[model samples]
Target: MMLTNAVLCLLIGYVGSHGRQEMFSVLVCIQTVVFVCCETVLYDAGLYRWQLFIITCVIAAYTFQRLHLSKKLPLRLSCFCMSLYLSKATIVLIEHFVFHPNKVPVYSYVTILFLVFMIIRIFVTEFDTNAHSFTGHLGLLCVSVIVNANPLIYVLSSYIFMTESAASDIAGLCSMVCGVLIIIAQSIHVPEDLRVRYTGVLGIFLGLVFIVFRPNLTPTLYSVFQWIEVFSVISFVIVMVTDSVTQFLQIMLCSAVLGLCPGFRAAIMLYPEDNIPVSGVLLFMLSSCIITCIILCFIKAQHLKHTFEKRFIKMSTMLAVVSMVAVISDISTRENHQMFLTLPSLKLILCANLVISICLKLLALRQIGELLPLTEPKDDKEVPYLPTIGNIATFISFVMICLMAPTSSFYHDVWCCGASLVLVCLQKDMRIFSSLREDNQTTATKITSLVILVTATLYRSDIWNYNSSWMFARGVTEIILVLFSIPNCYILWGLLYDNVLVLNEQIVIFTLPLNFPLILYSSSYTGWALAAAGIVSSIWMMFAKFALQPYHDDY
Candidate 1:
């Protein structure tokens, strides 16, 4: 009954969501139905977790029939389904044997919700319709599943020593056999042509350790073994899925797996009965040490200092950033403002990281700009300055909105200026703009405008502290402005990408008026009337000047 309700709620929520693909929606519904029905039938029949495991394998085969994934469907299903079911079984086994709470927490529903969200995020952000890329995303999804499933595996195995002697022996022997079979299957699936042949052998070795350590499983030992199995499964899947070999995907895979270990360890520590004395810190350090060793070996073998070295450094730096953020969050929650203030080191580190990240990103963007092929200078009359006019109109509308908005919290209007700057910077014909440049005048205008904008950003918080009543008014005005500008921005953004020629650098001159208005307007009827006038005129000018123009490439 509990399972049925959870599954039903999940399905209903999935169906009602906006912008979902039909195939994805159907796949989710079918999977949920199968999961609920299988649990219901198997539980009523008094089946062991092992029987449900076999049932999971059957479901995996059925899923492949529905989805029709190419290349090593059995192996993919085995890794995916086994990890999923093992976690499920581990939860059941622990509840039955170790600890039982009176009430099942609402957290299962939360878990399902999270699972759905992750599926959507992965599909939206990463997956494309291309088959190879889809396979890579699928492989990533499987790795995530394995990583998330590890905590349950640890909890189930943590107290193996405390179980009834005969039960422990039976469970140990069964686990040993299961591990061996998994390892053997993983080994066989490896292609013989690859020079890097030891992945399967390494998996086999990890499985053997799990088998050997089953008799005296401590919390620490169990966690170690579980991580090994989890990483081994990920490695095997990466090997089988050819498309997951790119540096970016590999970084994501490794980070997701290694990054969550602290959280998993901390969760166990948080529970009273489930509290394990093992240190999350030590576990993290161990994982890092192992990763570092592996990376060193790979670097030595590949000898791509330009590629691997840079990526590894970036990843390691990001990992440190994550750790710092975690520490700062932990400290802030304790309400120790004095300690936080005293820590100049933390502040310095954060500032340095911020500056470094910004510089690196700008460098990357500049490199990309350099690589873009130069296009032939088409006739200026081909595509009119329709986009530029639209942008100018929107900029005027935003300025009006800023003036009408409350004096407090008005710095958010700088976002409009930033948006305008982005449009200017992205112009492909950077050299063409210099022809329109009027000696030192444009440069002076740009510098003056930039300094003023930066000053506003630096002191906006303090400025808001002087008055609190404007807060609600500020939100209302901003929303109105956003609604007004969104259509205009969309049109202008499309125009920029359409390879049109226009005065790019002159957009920077508009920054002056964008920043100058904060000094002039009161949040009164007169201010609002002027704002309304600006909005109407700009939108009217946009449509009147550009709407009928055949500026679009297709037209």
Candidate 2:
């Protein structure tokens, strides 16, 4: 497993250093050989932190040494270091939260590989290989360094305590302070006065330093503060880079937002009887505030307004409702891992607040998306592939967020798929309501919609148990969600057929119900009626698309 991670890290570094697609297959072969050799010779050895660190350092060296490594060596090295630190941080996080120390298994290896692969893929893809903007690279470097410094800060603090080395402690402190100043400097836009920026930065640095190094603080509290600091730094970085909020930046920023959600879940540890070190209420409040602010800033960003749609609002609302319901259900049934005593009214209020907040922000997003553009770029340059890639990544992140919601009811599955279908509708210019504008339709489109609607109606009785009634409801929800995808399927196909997109419609169409599991759970009849209405509306919409097809000819 260690060797596999090592090889994977190396492959990722190689790819990052050389941003060409042609040599990707060759790198794959190298990874395979490294994996096979390591398995053959080092299978009996235990993985060690020192070994991983050494391998990372070696890769960093090699990455810096490569051809066409056009970026400044220091800058590239810093990025690689941050990437490696993030990868290690990921493994440490998984070990602490997801897996037991003594239970290192094959599945753990697979998960580690997947995590490393994703982090690497994101870094390599989002990185401006051409180095188009100096400030952009600097911003990324600064953010990564600030995030990467947390672990080091902890390690150095521990070392200072253990070794009683005043010199070492002072050196480390100075370096971190310098790092913070650099971040602030990079974060400033052109003509932005450095005096004001540094003043703000100095204030931020003092607060963070105080929180981090405050005496008598518990380990758990310290960790929480560290995360808060990182979250703030990320927010600052995003704001700084708003001018260049390209697809890569958007996706990176969104992914960071999603990654921070679980940290907010730590609020569950606040119960007195839980024996958790921190105040759960404080944790939850801090997390909620941070998350709300972050979401608001992200959705309201001037650069990202064009990328969102009405369906995104619907998707966010549905996911939030499902999550809230799942949490409430778990608490009511005493199925929650956190044994905190929560009142039903309190739960309902929390649930409603979360849903309403998300919906309101999403509504703002939709409004922004609909607003007229100031001016399209006159340069004949095509839109980059990065935006589409970012959209897909954001959708994946949404799916993961939905799946993370703890729920025993089939509502979780139903809503997750429903949200994903909404994502399909939101892609590019395609919208849930955009079918109203399209005048052209084919006979095949009508037939396809008819088949889907009838098939869903007919399968309800056989697949879902009527005695339970929720099964029927689940069936209807599935039907409605699929039916919603019917017109979207045509929209996506039209885009593909028109050469607006290089990919086929099936990519988005097939994923409509991909997360929806085969089994159904019992629930209320409300889902059924809603889903039935949705199905009927979807059928009507499909017919409308066909009926209105000829109207455009006269205009």
User: How much is the lDDT of residue 319 in candidate 1?
Assistant: 43
User: Which segments of candidate 2 are over 4 A away from where they belong?
Assistant: 1-206, 209-253, 256-258, 261-265, 268-301, 332-555
Please provide, for model 1 over 120-175, each residue's C-alpha lDDT reduced to its tens digit, 9 standing for 90 to 100.
33432223435465445444443443343333333444555454343234344334
Best candidate, lDDT: 2
TM-score of each: 0.21, 0.25
User: Which residue pairs collide, candidate 2?
Assistant: 270-280
Q: Candidate 2: deviation at residue 328, Å?
A: 3.5
Query: Model 1 segments beyond 4 Å from truth?
Result: 1-162, 165-246, 257-262, 266-305, 335-555
Compared with the true structure, the alpha-carbon lDDT of candidate 2 equals: 0.43
lDDT per residue (tens digit) for residues 1-555 in model 2: 555758676776787567554455345445544543453344234443535544654564355334224543334333344344445445444445545543444444434444334334333434433334534544444344344343333444555566433432443454455455444443533224454355446545544444444323245875565556555555545545455443434544553554343334444432334343333343344334434433544444445444433323433444344445545544554434644324222342343334344433344345454463322343555543322332443444444445454563444444444444323322332332224222322322333333433343444433356555666676566555545544544554454234243344334434434323222321333334334433443344445432333334555
Write down the TM-score for model 2: 0.25
Q: Candidate 1, after superposition: displacement of residue 544 in Å? A: 96
